[model samples]
Target chain A: MNTATIIAQEIPDIEKIRRDFPILDTKVNGRPLIYFDNAASTQKPWQVIKAIEHYYTNLNSNVHRGVHYLSQKATDAFEASRRKVASFINAEHDYEVIFTGGTTESINLVAHSFGKQFVKACDTIIISSLEHHSNIVPWQILCEEKNAQLKVIPINEKGELLMDAFKAMLDETVKLVSVNYVSNSLGTINPVREIIELAHSKNIPVMLDAAQAVQHMPVDVQELDVDFLVFSGHKLYGPTGIGVLYGKEKWLNQMPPYQGGGEMIKTVTFEKTTYNELPFKFEAGTPHIEGVICIGAAIDYINEIGLEKIDRYEHELLEYATEKLSEIEGIKFIGTADNKASVVSFNLENIHPYDVGVILDQFGIAVRTGHHCTQPLMDIFAIPGTVRASFAFYNTTVEIDIFVAGVKKAASMLG
Target chain B: MTINEIQDELIEEFELFGDWMEKYENVIQMGKELPVIDVQYKKEENLIKGCQAKVWLHADYKDGKVLFMADSDAIITKGLVSMVIRVLSNHAPEEIVAADLYFVDRVGLREHLSMTRSNGLLSMIKQMKMYAMAIQSKVKAN
Candidate 1:
């Protein structure tokens, strides 16, 4: 199914769509709640929520194990999710999709399995300074374990990566390059396609941490020619404890299994054991069945509305928010990339981000404030943290106005 | 004044704010009024764990009273720590350790605070009481 037709679909009525998310209607601290924390986790739509409920109520069973009707049903739903994810990201085959806990686990799987098989002593792995701790730590651990070195691609004061620096880091010794498609802290949309093409020319593989990107945009893995891509289901408006790691067939065939357990095994003995095929080889234990199935529902919900429309809507909202918030006094934007996501990280007049966050909460606005698991990025900017307000499609411009007032009030209160 | 009496006083003071904005302004002012801890006491040992904001607290026992001096990089956290210091400072070590901090709930900070901040507040109280307890034990041993 070509998603281009989905793109052609008219934009959904924003208010009508907001009603589908029950949490949007609630109040916080005696005021109508305005949630701008979408970068942390997008709230689940009723469709995805009901999918979970329906699974637990009727089709509750351990997938790929039981001979009962329920188990078969569970297994079908589980694989269906993988296929849906394959389509969502435009992976060539469903076998490319491997489920794990989330982006953290997805990166760790590649770092361990791919690194163990491919990375050698003295080999260098390239990463950006803008990565979340999850993306950075796993590679660091891999490099340390393998006696390999980790090289960093530096970013400018505006949080945009220096592409020339990225190119300079690529060489024969550069075994792998891992970077985030969208920075979690600053919302800088890295030129991932260019990075991938350049690295591929050097015979180096690239992995994308799309935890923040996939929900807000359409990601085509085949078009980008990325070796690996990953995202968390919860952040995509699905249940938690589910994520996907998409690797090319050739890479999956070469790398060793990530874990040893039942479903992932082809055959076992007291002697040597054989691992399962492409995906199951990596998926070792009993997976989050409900989370997997519901994520399918999440994709369906998004597709029904069309990702093209969602991206356009969110872009406008980001611009609107940036303009509105820029009017405030002493507001320093952490990122000002030409192309960016919906995340806005800034500080108010040297008032601690935590203080600003506390005051905003009183007005029933939810904005994430802190390092945002990007401690290294924080170090680059030479501050403790920034106040981050991220948006989604369901959020309205009226809420943005309320948020502006909240920030002004928070700043004055802190003063 | 008794701890309960001081707490009641604070609750009454907070009641005048028609909305949360004014209440938070008061907190910021209280934070500014909070005495800073000596540089020597802002060690890792004085830092409270599991808080979003970095907080350093120090307590000294003088003339049968426990006095708390604290600092936080975040104004909101500083305000919360100051509230703890205000209720317990200049009180006997035993009274400082035994005082029930109902003012948190009465001023509605207990409800307003997120779990992390509330845990931080509890951690501050725990550290202050621990200091008082150590002083009490040392006094007896001497």
Candidate 2:
């Protein structure tokens, strides 16, 4: 989609959306709840919650085994969820989507299965500095095991990936390139389309960790032409245990099965066993049935409201939050990427993020205060952690005002 | 009789120690108020993991009520531990489970704690609950 057209489509009604998430209505510490932990996991809407409750209360049975009505209903619903996930990301076929325990497991599945089969000694894998540990560690383990070289694409102080550095890293020996579509720590929306195209030009497979990006904006795998795209359900207002790993059909067919288990197998024998096709080959046991069903409901909810709407509202929230947070004395905002998501990771001068988080909690404001699983990124900034206030479509300008006031109070107390 | 009443009594008792900032003196004073656990009950099994400060909790179930004794190496945490034990101790397992701790905000201690210490408090409560659950399960098993 054209950038202008995308922006125009992305407007949301913030107050109306806030009501969908029941947890937002409660008090955290006597004060009203101000949830700023959207990046970690979003508060679930009624639709997603109802979907889970309905599944267990009505169609509670193991899928793909029994011919009984409950089992068939369960299997049909589960498969329908798979189809919904496939269409959500604009995958060519439903089989391209493999469900796992979230983005971490999705990345690990590719590393263990695809990496083991394809990556060999002397090969290279390229990753950016802004990657979450999930994106970085899996490749590091894979490279270490295969005796492959891991090349890092450096980021500028602004937290944007150096396209020149990325281009320089690419070569014929580069087996894979993995980068996050949006940084979890910095909220930098990476130019992933260019990165994918560059890697593809070198005939190297590209995997984009869309764990953070999928919530912020629409992810069209076909448009990007990425070899792999992975995201978690919880980050998108779904249940925690479910995640999606979208790979090209050719890659899916070529990679070996991740785990040997009942559901993933065609037959069981003492000597050898054949694996099931595409998704079933990767998903190993009786999966997180309720979580998967809830993810479908989440996707339906997002679709009905529209990704464009959510994206526009979140962008406004980010800009407002950034301006307000920047105004506070002794506050230094990190990751000043021009194009960014709704996260404002910052540190108050001389005050630990933990201390800042504690005082904020007194005001019933919940913000993430840690490395955000991006330790390498923390190392780049030469800090332990930042007080991260990540926004959602439901967040408001007034909430940002409250957050700023709370931050000001913390500063005075700590100072 | 109720968690709030116990909390009120604790606030009244804690005021005798003076400022909350003088945590070390407060700890010593609070320690004096703490009823002693049996010497035989003090063991490595009572220790909590992941706390930078040493904490030991011992519990005994009598007449379907669970009584607990807790101590910590750090003063503020010890005071906090004492506060938790005051309400939780000498309560039935079911009563302890039913008690809502959201009123902890009223203590005004959360602002003083770092996020890690707050997490430790949460972990301590979870451990207490787990202990209660273990006791309940054992009774069911019997």
Candidate 3:
């Protein structure tokens, strides 16, 4: 009906793409479902869902230890997933990839093992204000145990990290720098390439919390020269309870095993024990086999449509939503960084975000409200929280229109 | 009115609404009309946990009846809080403790009473019942 809406409807074969996700066709509150919570977790396409059903139906066995046929089959499929993930992120080696419970565990693996190995008292670890609590809390725990100081790179009013402040904070005492490639709360695509290069120049390793970044864009770790990267599977349209932690082989070799169990060790004795090599050193247990394999299927799904196309389409949705939403009265847009992904965070004047979200939910629009596990970021904005509408490729401009209308109704009703 | 009678009255009133939006509009109006809690009692200790919106509930026991004052930063939550207070306030502690609170479901706002809602209506109800039971014990002691 508006200019932005008209332009965004031009993306081709969107209906076909939408058909792949059965949930997209489902109803919520007697209205057609409009899923805008992609930042939280994405809906699975039939391909990825079928991959899960297929894995359990045929290949169900313990990987890496089985002498039986099913075990070898499972092992081959699991290792093949590792390889797919390695190539998906362009990791130098498949052995460099470690499967953890989720992004939180992957981060803890680094914070615990890497921290135990390298971090000492008085050493500084730097993170950005835009980090989710997953990235913040692990470092806090690591710093607390190691008696290390954790520093934050402050952000401006627009939610963009101040690079000059980051540059000034870099020194010999700073051991590792961890920040998100894209802020989960703000949708700011951080200048990670620059951050990685800068940290590398100081001989400090950099870890990227790519939980919000990997699915939205094609992340080539070698191209970024990043020392470590982490992302969750569910966010990428895969099964839940699985995540990828990609570290340089050098760093993975140096860090001790994260957990002591059957899969992570080569030999065990009363007085002497040895950990397994590279990824097994960090994995520590039988991994989530279904999650691992189906995440590869999710990758295949993303590749089928291509990340660049998905990125472009989602960006269009973001722009259209932002434009349509701005037309409403007294609506304040939060996190207006120049570079953003498929997210728009905003607040209606004098109306609580929870109130807005409740109204929107009635209209069958699913958006995230509240701090989004980034309470510190909410404090920085000096507001209770903002209504966040995040998009995936399947979401269309018509849905955005309904969402905009719902928000306008909410604002007028609550104003 | 008795607790069941009050719940029946609420269910009757809610049945008049044609849709969820109209129902929500009524709730928002009720939120605007809610009696504000005293500023002194709006402290962190009185705050309800496990809610996206901050709900502050304070109770007063007088003449064997538990009177409640509640507020929330979010208007819809405040509205829900007001509905809760309307149902159970000015009742004997035992009656308040034993109230079924089926009106929340009968009125089609059952989702708010769900544990996964995070709106704190369920938590608020629990807190209010807990307060009443505590008062009931102290009254027996006297």
Candidate 4:
């Protein structure tokens, strides 16, 4: 077989990849489990899981403030994870990576740190309608506190951003332009390269919420020249409660520390306290050390498979799924962007998405249903929600076939 | 009929269906046959909070028996609530409050609901019983 065929066959080996995820073998309601809720959180492979167990068992120690052997080992592993993430996103400096609780905390960190230093009264923050509440709410709070205005770049019915509208809104008063690289609800991939270049020409810093994008495809912060990018580890098949916020060094140096605590201090006296340097300045308290170490393993896992191959396989899977699902009567897609991810959001004729979700779960298929934390986007679409089946590379065509049959069963019962 | 008898009847009704798909189809039919509640009572206060799907349940007492009228945005939730109403409604306030709802387990519905939906179902039951208690207190006062 040729190289492409070899990789294609290996990338989506249904039985082989299924073994990596222990949960996939388990039965749900007496049927083999079919997990399509990857966007919610990806299941961990043995590589990532074993790494976490290895940390807790052999190397459990506090990082960065101890002279003991285990402490040094822990600190080394923690910082090594930072370096791994730094290269994973291709950041210019290792110190540019700041560990936060998750994507929410990372966005809030930027909103606090970057907002305090640069944003002023009458300054406007531009975000898209497709943003998760994490992205939208922090900016809203920042705008409220700073006496600034929050402007939105609306999307067309297809869920793609209206670049012309975004261009019209771009002006000197706009302090920052923030948009998701891939929409969590719609799977629509925004033209982030163009978005960054557009804002850069106007001398505005751009932030990307890559929570959904980084795992599905390759993301290089340096290549995109994105000022700030944030993503959660759990969504990338790693442990939950740990995530990374990558900031450009220039911006990191200019912005203030997000939270004041034990590790984030350079020097503290009774009168005055100075904050620590980049990465440490933003990270406060004892971090999710095991989560960090295992995320590094997760990155290693992805690299072994190769992101380009994974991306190619997922695109084909999405194409196949879309074509199969389209044949169902009364089925309508919510997002139809030309550039898309492995997310499929749809609804049957008049059945509520929640009803569809319940029926699908009965058949051992998992999907997300509701506004998906993008209530405004749901409002824009005039929908309560869409039943979302988000795929990962490990998911196969056979599972997609099962999902179609499950959806058909749901439609029959609900319609 | 007594609440136990009513629940037994539902269990008997569901026992006829050989498979989950057929049972679910019957549940959907039962949900569709549910009477609509007054539009005004579908407000936020009457809405059940624990459910993933919005379920609004309104209650009233007439001739010492409690009446429950409910509607849900999701058909499955509606179906579940309709069953709850059928077993408990038209009973005396004290009997409604004291009644144990065993039909859910007897009919094999406990396994089908998601964690959130199961919690919602429990809360819906609790809310119905709460309505019964409140009605009993008022009748005692008068």
Q: In candidate 3, what are the lDDT values of residues B11-123, reduced to their tens digit?
A: 99999999998999999999999987889999998999654788999999998899999999999989989988999999999999999999988999888877767887788
Ranking by lDDT: 3, 4, 1, 2
Q: Sort by DockQ, best first: what order? A: 3, 1, 4, 2
lDDT of 3 by residue, A1-415 (tens): 8655554455577878889999998898889999999999999999999998998899999999989999999999999999999999999899999999999999999999899999999999999999999999999999999999999999999999999999999999999999999988889999999999899899999999999998888999999999999999999999899999999999989988888988888899999889888888877778899999999999999998899888877887888888899899899999999999999999999999999999999999999998899989999999878899999998888899999999999998898
Model 1 per-residue lDDT tens digits across residues B62-82: 788887888988887788888
Model 2 Cα shift for residue A30 (angstroms):
1.9
| 1 or 2, greater by DockQ | 1
Cα lDDT of model 2 by residue, A262-331, tens digit: 7999988999899998789998899999888889999999998888878877887787788778889999
3 against 4, candidate with superior DockQ: 3
Top candidate, metric DockQ: 3
In model 4, residue pairs whose N, Cα or C atoms come closer than 3 Å (at least 3 residues apart or on different chains), thus clashing, are none
Clashing residue pairs found in predicted model 3: none
Candidate 2 error regions (>4 Å): A1-13, B1-142
Off by over 4 Å in 4: A1-14, B40-45, B49-52, B111-115, B118-123
Q: Give one digit per residue, the lDDT tens place, for model 4 in A1-415.
A: 6433644675646567768888888898799988999999999999998998899998899999999999999999999999999999999999999998999999999999899999999999999999999999999999999999999999998999999999999999999998999999999999999999999999999999999999989999999999999999999999999988999999999998888898999999999999998778887788888999999999999898788888888887888899999999999999999999999999999898988987888898999998889989999988878999999988888789999999987887798
Fraction of native contacts, model 2 = 0.00
Interface root-mean-square deviation, candidate 4: 1.7
* lDDT measured at residue A271 in model 3 versus the true structure, 0 to 100: 93
CAPRI grade, predicted model 3: medium
